[model samples]
Target: MFIYASPSVERMYGATVDEVVERPIQDSMTPESFQKALQVFAEEMALEQTGAADPMRTRTIELEEYKKDGTAFWVESTLSFVRDARGKAVGVLGVSRDISKRKAAEAEKERLARINRQLQRSDSLARMAAAIAHHFNNQLQVVVGGLELAMNQVPENAKVFATLRKIREASRKASDISRTMLTYLGQISGARCAIDLCGVCKNSLPQLLASAPKTVSFETDFPQEGPVVLADGEMVRNMLANLVINAWEASGEGAGVIRIAVDTVEPAQIDSRHRFPVDWYPDDTRYGCMIVEDHGCGVIEADIEKLFEPFYTTKLMGRGMGLPALLGILRAYGGCITVGTALNQGSVFRVYLPVFQGKPSDTMPHPVSMMQQYPKNIGVLLIDDEDMVRDIAEMMLKRLGYEVIKARGGKEGIELFERHHQSIDVVISDLTMPGMNGWETLAGLRAVDPQVVVILSSGYDEAHVMEAGGPIDPPSAFLGKPYRLQDLSRCMQDVLGRFQKPSECPGDRLQNALQEMPDGAFHKNSAEGT
Candidate 1:
């Protein structure tokens, strides 16, 4: 029972002293709070009745409390048991202070800390991904290059050619996966050129549509011209593909529609629609925007901010790298992405890329054919740590009618080049090696002959290699590993043909090259002997 009340009760519980005095304390509390306070009161009464030595005289607790108006707030209450001179409890004296604001602030602080930790973990994973990609690409080069050379030797009609082609195709798929990993690691490969946004969408549509289930239909609305962006065409396609696939999967197994549209967006419009940082865009600029919308179960509001976070997914089997990689590619080119979603309604993912100012140029390289006859007397020094790769490359050079010299490693290759620098017209050097790398070998060769026509080959893309601080002096030409015979032939012709004079005999063509190869052709040859 409340025997007395102070004026503070008016502000704390919306009751004046006169109204609260002599009223049961439970009358001022909610049913839950009343029950909890009664239990504690009963426990103290029992302690007093038993005359327990050093009994609890006071207690503090935090709980939800309500005012006369029924508004609830958290309160920290300290209750002191009043006792008579004989040590028998008579009444209670309590004091409480509102701590709601402090609790709310602490909760917000904890939420921010969780987000910070997640971002830190993401950064660590990105670094690990980069290291893995570098090493994986190195080993993949050997597998791909060796398979490519073996396929070249097999006749088109041979039984083994079909099997070898399938293996090479699988290897190429593995290469694609590695490239995706690099993208997630914040490594964007390929040159940036002015590319037509509409054209990329049109080209990617067939594949994207084919991947969707039959229950879903796709609609596209692209401007005929004028929305061009300076970006890698392949990366744009990949980003579109991922967005479309995500929409397709989200559309459920029932009949649905996936809509893709492209338009030009002003900086002001972007700022109004997205919560991106103020520095994300320039004050006056236009962006080429691609929007992919789907009629499906949309993401919840709470999860929207986390959609681009690495390895965060709502799906059971998802590895969660798709959206992160897409975002990484966009950010690499000073672009951004925004999304809109509603539960059970649908979702819209908008990708914005900075608009290119000038007229778009055709940056795609013309395909080169390797079926042409080779000019004779050209020499190539093949350097590789892997014996299989070295032997296969030697066979490829021999078939192309070039005099070949093999080196097991970069150090030996440099020595071999020094001894036969004049004779070696071209050096085909592997990028990753045990002792000395391709860059070092290139540097050593350039010291001996500045005009050294060296072709740098690697499993990794040229951009990724260069970004990782590869050779300062770029090679005459670059050959991506796992290249076909035609690619090798064209590269050699392009590099060697530039130096050869009109009077020089075209390299002697090897008649019946595959059929006439001796058994010793597969044997490893030391750099000293070559």
Candidate 2:
């Protein structure tokens, strides 16, 4: 027997009514669809044959159907069992509507949901990283500052001094780890400025290559008129260094080439390859792109998505912060990164930064001479909640020939400053405190005297503090915690020099101060201080 076919059947299956009506239903379906239809039919027949009280009279299912041209599309079909005079199932009638658009929409929605979950996880990890970096940095400040003071007291040539130097060096390595964690958390302390991408790469190549194995070779393609980007120069340098090191390590012990290139590209060109969001591009829509390529044991497809996550690594000695920190830096600068990888072949990483409008300065600032003398008679008001930090900072300031005033907390520091603002030539306040934190203390001091010379100090990175509105008014200078004696000295001198001329101080002032101390002075002070 032949079944009737509607005119709409032609529209659905790209076949005329005559062509569809004469053929069996299975003839028009793919093998998978035909098998599925047979299974459903067999199930209904079995129920009917068993004489079930409530047999399946109608059912709905989704499946793939083919057109006359062999194109496939999804269909949701409702089938009814046609019965004979004895009420036995004989034929089938199905009404189906194309659901391909709906299915595509569902797939897109699922993809978006997955991306959202990934973003949420990244956010959670960032928050945890911030908390850890803040506390660890604070503890490091105490350790490092104390060690610096102790080292100063010991003679440079003494064996004890050598031991202390090693301890100090180890402490600094720990501080670097903290900084890496913070950077991955998008809490960088440095301010963004116009940077020549090529210049940073060229300058950092020596250091990066020094860490690479001798078997590996390096090639660079930096254009003479390289694009300048709006980003922190130090962060960029660190990012490049990490990437180059990662490439070198991945290349294994075999001979391989690592190539670095910097060029200017349009956002459209980048989007065509990477599909980044429009918001990632600046108004000009031009990007300064830096590409690092290596012939190495490349990342596998399965691990590519997890590469930017913190603490995810495959190497034996990998800390896993390198790529994640690179990601953080790009995100902080409103930039994007993409990776092209093939297992056992190689990898190419493209970093895109917003191109700055102005040309970078041609002249580099003069390096500070090591023998430059610091001014004496400068007064410093130090505010910190940590007792160890206060003591160590006080010791360092006194050694530098500066008059030091110490306060336990921000509130007390403000009170002291109000009473002795004239005597306090400069204020060095810690950003984090129990009550009246650094920002609040700065505001209070500013209210008392608009011309107050304040240097904001924080264990947190400058970017993190600034993100929390710590530098709204802009301090005279910023001092990162866990700093060395030389770093602190230079920061203070630079800040003070900007406000007033440095007075001539005796070259032997530090030695004189150390000599004046009585024997076992450190032990005596420790007993009384405790």
Candidate 3:
């Protein structure tokens, strides 16, 4: 046996086959994998002794193995037995197959599964986008209106400034999250540019700190420069936000510390295939990294391998969207994220973004949409189950020089609209509620006036609203829940503008039709890509 394996086994184990042959098989296997194989062998032995015709008894446990030089690969395997000699097993025979191809296939299968999971997350985002529209829009209106209202009363030196600062910070968070959600869903496209590595980290700290649980302490260590990466500012922020929030949540309300750092690395050529921590490669470059380390209860050994998988969260409340969404955005930009952890010590998530030549922007676009049109004061009827939201919207619209109407439910909203639909130019309603939700309320409103401008908002859809061939109604406007006032106003203006303008004959529309009509090269790519 040793002579037959002398050359190859020597190459694989950094030892002569003669040396390896004398050692017990246990010495040749990794502790964990060895134990598992031993258990399988025991089961196989039992089945054979019972005269059971089991195919699994013939199965061999192949494993990827590493030599002392650190090069690694797959090996086929089998087992030997011990017994008395009347053809009664005195010893056993061991056989193994070189299974590199099978190992490669397994890895490829894993990669494809990861990608499919990520694609599946597109629906989660669509759900969140549609679901939070109303909530987000109204929240933004409050935040923006609050700041606008406080702008008059707040002074730079006042003692109340500290408290005001919190409100502003929270409002900023509210607006940013709403916009960030949209950005994740690709509802909005972002400017692509190169950005500073540490600068993005520093700016992100403030928000990350704001979101952490009160008990969790945070720290940062970022060098001024090493490498810069081309990335979408909003997308990067979203990824960082999710990671930071995850760390906090894992840290358990307030028992742990989360530390983040930035560094640059260049891995060996062999690491390229596995380089992506998130496995969703952005663009093809290889340059930058953002290291997010959390000292929360570390991930279990079993869960570590599946950490980046979509919908695979260790947290009880985790919908598992955050990390996967983070991965999607990074992948779109030609980057990848990775996770590493030791039990009880916590996890370190490393985000690798290929650095490029261009310079990154210092300031991100403000969460507020920069509308070209100066907004005109228009009457808005606000309907929501929550009071803080209603009061908030009421104060905001009134301050904007528009009369406002408020209602607690869809029914009340319909009543108010019935009494004043002529004067009410816009109806802002939430979709998910106990009764008379936004969709139901809009149906009632449309019955009153098919011409009445309507904005539908919701936090989620019970049905597959975005599925291909899903029924689509021609609502005049849609504002996703959690939209800022700017988004709400944008939808309202868009819908109203569409109603006022002529369609199907505009020069731009005509130009688009001409451009899209029989463009062969562009056509081929779309068909092949999807």
Q: Score candidate 2 by lDDT.
A: 0.77
Q: Itemize residue pairs with steric clashes in candidate 1.
A: 375-506, 375-507, 376-506, 376-507, 376-508
lDDT of 3 at 164: 72
- Sort the candidates on lDDT, descending order: 2, 1, 3
List model 1 lDDT by residue over 1-530, tens digit each.
Answer: 66777788788777678877756666666788778887887877776677664645688876677776778777788988777897666678888788889878987797668667766766787777766765676667667666766775689999999998898888888777777776765566578889899888988988887878899898989888759899888889988988988898888888989999999988877743433221245447798999999989998888876777666888865467788888777756777888888999999988888898887789878766555555565667788887767766776676666777678888888877776565567889988887788888888889989988899887666776666544377888888766666778899888765655566342432222223334543222333223
Q: In candidate 3, what residue range of length 10 has the lowest lDDT sum?
A: 521-530
Point out the higher-scoring one by lDDT: 2 or 3: 2
RMSD of each: 7.6, 6.2, 13.9
Q: Taking the tens digit of each residue's C-alpha lDDT, what string does model 3 give over 1-530?
A: 23235467775678776777676656566666668777876776676677644433346677655555655667887765544644344444557656778888988898789756645665665686645754675656556655655654679688877787777678777665555454444443345677787877788888777767779888888897757777667667777878888887777765778888888776432134333443343444455778778887887866764565546776665467677567546645556666677787888888877777766566555443345343343456778787776666565455444445667898887876776565556777766666765667777888787877766664322122222113435456555544445555566556555554333232333233334333321111122121
TM-score of each: 0.69, 0.77, 0.52
Candidate 2, residues 6-102, lDDT tens digits: the string is 7898888898989878777776777898899889878877777788736456789888878888898888989887778887777888888989899
In model 1, state the lDDT of residue 47: 68
Give the deviation of candidate 3 from the true structure as CA RMSD: 13.9
Task: Return the number of clashes found in candidate 3.
Answer: 32
